[model samples]
Each structure stands twice: as C-alpha cells, then as structure tokens.
Target: MGSAGVRLGRLKANTSALFVCDIQEKFRGLIHGMPAVVDTASRLVRSAEVLEIPVFVTEQYPKALGNTVAELALPPKALVFEKTKFSMCTSDVDKAFRKMNLDGIGQVLLCGIETHVCVLQTVLDLVEKHNVEVHVCVDGVSSQRETDRSVALRRLQGLPNVFLCTSEMAMFQLAGDSKHPKFKQISALAKEKRPDQLSAL
Candidate 1:
C-alpha cells in the first residue's frame, strides 16, 4: 500500500527496465499462482515492446532449471542475462547492468517469480547500491507460501526507494494513455484469463 512516488524524470523509456527473475521451468510449479505470473509477465513484455523500453531477464542456471516458461513468449529484443549469483549486484552482474546503460536508469520496475528470495534480494541491491527506485508488482511475483511472500513485501515497503504495486497499476503507468494504438492489445494481454471477459478480448 505504500509507495515511493515514481521518479518521472528517470522513469522515461531509457531510464527504466523490467527485470524478470527466474520464471523458468524448475521454479514455475513451485510458486503460488504460476499461470497468473506468466500472464502478468507476458503483459509486461508486451507493454515494454510497444513503448520501446528495454526489458531484461535472468535465468538462474538454466542447464539445471530450464528456460523461461513457454507462456511468457519473451520478446526477441529483450536482454537475457545469465547468472549464478543470487544478487545481481555482484561485480560481474553490475558490469552487465552498466553495459546496458542502466547506470542512468533511476527506476527499475521489477516483476518475476519467487518473491521471497531472488526478487527481494535484487530489489534491495538495486535500492542500496545502484540507488535506483524499485517498484515490484505484487500480483506479478509470488512465493509458494503466502506468509513468506507477505513478509518480504512488508520489508520491501519499508525500504527507502521501493514501491509495492499490483499488476494493473504497473501496466497502466507504463501505458500512459488509453488512446495509444497498442492499448487494446496490451489490455487484452492483461485480461487474458478473466473467465467472464476472456472471450471478449
């Protein structure tokens, strides 16, 4: 419910990126709502593509865990960064981040699987070291246990530069306009699974 106001100056196309942490095979079945996570991430990727914003993804040891889930259908333009480290702020990872021109990125809108560990660690690192604003969409990330997910969200909300939001809020912010041509397409992606409305889209 708490929010660190969006940094409009740095939230522009070039100053923000979406980091999708291990929403891969080995971890998919273990999360609270796998399908919803896939849908939300898919919608995010679609929005990012329409807006021409950079999207970054991480695969945690894909050889053992497997690739990102099939439902996501990540954009080919997206940057897929491989890493073994839990925290992406480590020397090598940070270098990759810098190479992406993320040093100027003031806000990082994050969404992915496994909210309690990898997502939490990455958010803290981005806030503490990179001094980047962190906004995590609650509905887009989850843990196998609700209690752990709740605890992690509470801790993230207390941080200096972090915001916890629902998937709708994040998507609308990125959309910036209902008149945008891709609005219906992006909206369709967001509403893909609502039983009553799915057919309409």
Candidate 2:
C-alpha cells in the first residue's frame, strides 16, 4: 500500500475550483457574526480569484434572500447557481461543476454563511455524492447561534477528506509559491480594510 510516489492530495494547486455557498444578502445578516464572516469570506474569494481558480457560487433562493452579499466581489461571469435545497448537488450547481471540469480538480475549497445548514449540507453532498475533496475556511462560515456553529464544524471535522482551514490557510494553499506572480497583491489584499481594496485584488 505504501508505494513510493507523490501523493496527489498533498500537491498544491491540484485543483482550481472554489464553491462559495449561501452567503446571501438576507441570510448572512441573520448569522451570528456577520461582519467577521463577510470579511473572511471576501478574503477567501479574492485569494481564489487571484490564483485563477474557477469560482462557483450559490444563493439559496436568491429571489427570497435577494442576492449574495456585495463584499464577495464576484467576477463578471462567475458561475452562480441558485437553489432551493441546501445541498448544492441538487440544483444547477452540479451542472456548473461539470462545466468547470471537476475530474482534475482534486480539491474544492468552500466558504459561506450559516455553517450549520447550507454550508454543512453542501460540503457533505460534495464529498459523499461527488467525491470532491473539501477544504472549509472556518472563519468564513457562521451560524445563527454559536452552539450550532460549533456543532456544524464538529460534524464536518469527522469527514476523512475535509480540512477545516482558516482564511490564511486557504490563501497560502492557493498561493502555491512565494514566487507566484500575484503574491504581493494577494498579501496586500490580506491586509485590506477599505471597500476599494476589493477591486484591486
């Protein structure tokens, strides 16, 4: 079983896909810690985009929740799929994933609001149903209650392929190397506090 070969799972930039789940306008404001979630999620999106990762976004019934929060800085043509079910698999999300060509994408990075409901369900579905390796940014997800948030993370931590990462962790993983062309801009984005910083990254 221990063949001497490079483990693909340990390779960086092996996947260029990101799934930002249910950080909708109405829903995110109701989460326990809106500001922190928004800040971290924004940063995660920026890092992913800077690394040229294909972004997949979800809005659980955007007609009802309005739309994803403005802080995300969505690309002009990001794959944004709306769904009624909490699991992104059940909706056009899967189709979007197909379009993104997931076969070579060994990892899927996840960030969003309501850690217990949409984010948790989506992560499980992506792993169990689609077999996508998952990386969750802990600071980017939240719940309406601290207890529920803690419980959700506990549940996700049990998954064999799921890594509970921080915003900084996700950023560096995508960075690949200090020599990556966007390193400086990405570093500056990490310290950005003003709204205008969104466009620069």
Candidate 3:
C-alpha cells in the first residue's frame, strides 16, 4: 500500500495510459517467458483500445533489437518511439506525450521486457521525474533470468509511486465493474492463461 496521504487510487481509463517497452524480436529467445509477456501485453493493448485509453510504445534501438514482436497486436493509433536510452523518459518520448496531449494523464500502465534493466529504469524515471503513478504488469514483464525479474520487482515494490500488479488485475480495475461496457471482453481476455513462469508471481 502507498502512504495514507498519497491517494494512490485505482486506475481510471480516462486518466491512465499504457506504455509498452522494448518487447522486441531480439529478446524473444533471450528473455524468459517471452510468449507470456507478448500475450499479456497484447491483451493490455487490446483492452486499452476497447476502453479508449491512450497507448504508447518504445523500441530500444530498433536497428539492433528489431521492432516490437509481431504477435502483439499494437493498436493502429498507438504512438511508437525508437530510442537508444535504457530509460524511456527521453526527450523524444516526452515530445510524443506532449503531441498526444497527455498532460492530464495521472497513471501509466507499463508492460514489456528485460524487467531488471530498461523496465526498471523507466519505472523509476516515470515516478521520480514525471511525478506520475506507475503500475507494472508483473506477468507482462521479464528478463533473461528469473532471478533478475524477481529482484527488480522486489526493488520496485519499495517505491511509493510504483504499484505492482498483474495484467488481469489492471484490466478489471480499469473496467471498474461488471457493468462496464468493456467488461465482457476484458473478462474473456483475463481467462487466457499466461506462461507457467508467471504462475508464482
């Protein structure tokens, strides 16, 4: 839980956005549970579209790492940025946020690869520099080693502005209730199984 005065509340579709980071073709073989990460990230992207939430994606050095995985169904209007920076909070990313008119966004939902490196750095930067609440999809993030992912998650959990969650939890929270228009679609998406590697998380 966050500090009592912090007011870290549930995600509101209108005030939240999704950021997919560095889940590229190059790491498909290197990262553990790549399939699960792609699947969960895809589900989140689709759910975001259904809920009319904005989505942004970052590819770390696309020339070397390749583009985002084809399995993931990125929304047509999603903003895509290619960057060399490990932390995605670069000027280019900032420009994209500005272009998208994201000044009102309060929370960012994050999903993607190498949890210990790029993902961790981006989460810290978003919370400290941007002053926005960050929620990580545990099942949608990973590293080459399980230990790296576990350690990174443990470290991130200690941050007051960083909220750790699963893809299903985020989807439901964003939907708010069973009566939400997208509830049935989100519910179906949640029923899909993630890799066994994410089972313990």
Global lDDT scores for all candidate models: 0.73, 0.74, 0.86
Instruction: State every prediction's TM-score relative to the real structure.
Output: 0.83, 0.86, 0.92
- Give me the runs in candidate 2 sitting further than 4 Å from their true place: 1-11, 99-103, 193-201
Clashes of 1: 0
Model with the higher TM-score, candidate 1 or 2: 2
Which residue pairs of candidate 3 clash? none
User: Which is superior by lDDT, 1 or 2?
Assistant: 2
RMSD of 2: 4.9
- Once fitted onto the true fold, the runs of candidate 3 whose alpha carbons sit more than 4 angstroms away are 1-4, 98-102, 197-201
lDDT of 2 at 147: 85
**Candidate 3 lDDT trough over 10 residues, lowest sum:** 192-201
Q: CA lDDT of 99 in candidate 1? A: 64
